[model samples]
Target: MGKLAQLSGPVGLLLTAALTGTVGFLPQPAAAQSLLQQEGTLAPMQDTYSFEGEADQTLTITLTSSEFDPVLSLLDPDGEEIARNDDYASVLDSTIIITLPETGSYTVVATSFSGEGGSYAVEVHPTTEYEQVFDRAVQLFNSEDYTDSVEAFTAAIALDDSQPSVYLGRANAYLGAAYLALGENFAGPQSLEPEVRDAIATDYEQAAALLKEQGKPDLAASLEEQAQIFRLVEPEPAPLRPAEPPEEPANSQS
Candidate 1:
């Protein structure tokens, strides 16, 4: 049995739903679906977001799910795994620390290597001398506070463009802002502004191209994956609930 198998029911369901891909939930015409779910639930929760951290500092991570053993990893700007653990042994209920290189944005992937069970809380970006602007942008995105994330990301990019990763990070922030407004005003998912999505895709592509030019294939691939993050959030049918009172019909002219 996988490490997550020992987890209880409520926690297992939460983690399973978080990690599993949208495609995995629906039925397929040709093949049977795998029993495993891919994503884990965050304690508060957000699918994509950012945090701040100092350069070359150990960032702490915590796990809290009933179903899975959380493996926290920090991917460097060049897209290399600076830290990981397939053998984290015990300390299952405690915190773990990992460090990042340089002062820039890094993708912190919290995955359940075992099965479907685990919830996690991570504290990376420090509020010290070296503030985490990128992380701040992500927090804004998480809270649907788009205007600030956009401004923060823009400010970050303006300060430094030497790093291709920063461009991609800010691009995502901008996209999130646009998406937030689009979601609020529009009637359905189909109403997402195509121009905005295209802008995001294009910007992300540029970031990936820059990475490729720098000869960082791994980082480039991760950037490409990020380009698809928003592409797959399928909407579920409305849930059953008590009916609301009907609105009054307009009166006919005399």
Candidate 2:
């Protein structure tokens, strides 16, 4: 069974109730509110919500369900898709953090990843500066803009160094930047600059140490394994030699 199917908690109970038709009528779309939490059942149709946001304000939207993987989308006042997410971190829940581009009513779409029906909860609220920066860094990493992602993750760390995810994010960004520098015809680790390679290793070590301190030894061990990649040394390739001319045919051929 999938992880979502294996969920055992309040969410699982809610899903069971939904599947058994025990849940009440679906709630109406939420009105514009500074902080809102709405519960509803997705019966193959997406639930839409509205929220008022100011330009430059950071908004955090989260969708959680146990019956199916959740998908969240943010649409601007003009109905343009501003941001979307299928999963937050490695979980089935979805989250989208974005800074409002203009002051207007925004729409939030709550749906399942595979159109499966289940009970779900949606939350919309303003987030802190640190979350804003950290989320931006994650978006940059997803887009493969590693250099900028590193800068954004560093800024997030500056805002709050308590988050282990930020450190891990910066480590991945550093590693990505190193690989990007090597390009398609990469010659392995030897082709990366010492400083660049060292940065990747250092960030991973830092993240692992932080994870260990947070009692996440398993995740820390994983990070340690990832860090070892930068320490690998690829053996030098053997030089190419010119092909020798073919030997003359034997006399028997004549």
Candidate 3:
């Protein structure tokens, strides 16, 4: 399977629909508008729409349906999968927040995860600065570029400090960086600098507080526990190198 098929939940269905000439295309909409809304039926097939997008433009695309579980994917002008979402949060709906890398006509794909037919609504809108930064940070995190991810998440926090998820993201980035610094197999947290270690704990604490304020006590408690454990963990000792073999003893006989 191609990368698009792997990342996009139902691209196989999309391909089948395409091969059978069953795929449907929605009306092309102007991308300059602040908001674009489309209502369509999946009918056990995928629906595609095209709109112009600009470089560095951040957009939040949401797919919602009461009839079936929705999956959404965005493709660049080159038909590369830019972003795909099977679910947002813990719900069946889907949302993709992405920053366009270049200007071109982008395609939006809407389909059902389970091959069930249903009416769905797709919305495209430019995201706020904070969301764009947060989305980039998340992309960085997923790519394992923890250092840049940390910076991006920090920028996001500066823009909107009230979001628990931002704090959580930064904490994860910090932890990832710590692991990278100490070597992936280094156990515990001993080798980590005090400042970096403390930063990780602090971000988790902050996230927990924010989640508590949001009335999500269970999630808040989990973060709190993680912070406590992280603070107490110790790094494992580095492996000892094997001693060099004794130098040849015998030249003396001569």
Candidate 4:
């Protein structure tokens, strides 16, 4: 018998219940997409969702299942597997992002890695203006124009709050601007302007939380450490001035 058969009856029942709980927490398509959400129980072992695609257009497909490890695969019009992903950002759920090679109908398959399927939800969204703005923000960051980069990233976030990666980029911009404003001695928080340092720490904290939620635990931990460093920076002590040379006896002579 397989491992499933070795499990105690109660343990097996608990496993089944855990999978059942995931069905209620599946995410629907974002309102920004204005598309109808697609949801269904896996047909025994697999389910396929079909949608039209356009050349050069970016597409995002997400699959979530409560009972099994979801596997997502994309197939082109000719039924060739274009790309596939098992987990998105280390999360149990699966997400696939791609730029269509040609205009045609594409197939997205939702299935389990172990062939144990259950309730699942799938959503497809096309590239929007938010993507364009995000690209621009990235360009500004690369150009080292940290101030403008922060503004551009903020704009992108306003456009799509659902995207957690944007928070990471914005946090970087904030850190960059803080250091640039210092011009020198940016290593320690003591050398930084109080307001600037505070902003940097705040952004880092926000990024850490968002990254954790996005299933990037390692990155989140790193950012949290950086934030703590700034928060713990002690004010530098004032440099002591050399005592003035003893005044000449001219005062007594006068």
Report the CA-based lDDT of candidate 1 relative to the real structure. Answer: 0.46
lDDT for model 3, on a 0 to 1 scale?
0.69
Off by over 4 Å in 1: 1-131, 184-198, 217-254
Per-residue CA lDDT of model 3 for 44-93, tens digit only, reads: 88888777778998777777777888899999999999799985533467
For each candidate, what TM-score against the reference? Answer: 0.36, 0.60, 0.57, 0.48
Off by over 4 Å in 2: 1-34, 37-56, 64-68, 75-83, 87-93, 99-107, 116-121, 187-191, 233-254
Question: Can you write out model 1's per-residue Cα lDDT over 1-254, one digit (the tens) per residue?
Answer: 11221111221211111212110010001121211123346432223223444577645433334455555555676667676543221223222345556776555555565544445543332222112454465457557686787677566556544445445545656665666666667553245566666566555666667667767666566656655643543455699998998999999999
Q: How far does residue 130 in candidate 4 sit from its true spot (Å)?
A: 2.4
TM-score of 4: 0.48
Q: In model 3, where do residues sit more than 4 Å from their true spots?
A: 1-57, 63-70, 75-83, 86-94, 98-108, 112-123, 233-254
**Candidate 2 — worst ten consecutive residues by lDDT sum?**
21-30
Q: How close is candidate 1 to the true structure, as a TM-score?
A: 0.36
Better candidate by TM-score, 2 or 3 = 2
- Arrange candidates, best lDDT first: 3, 2, 4, 1
Write the candidate numbers in order of decreasing TM-score.
Answer: 2, 3, 4, 1
Alpha carbon lDDT of residue 238, candidate 1? Answer: 92
Best by TM-score: 2
TM-score of model 2 vs. true structure: 0.60
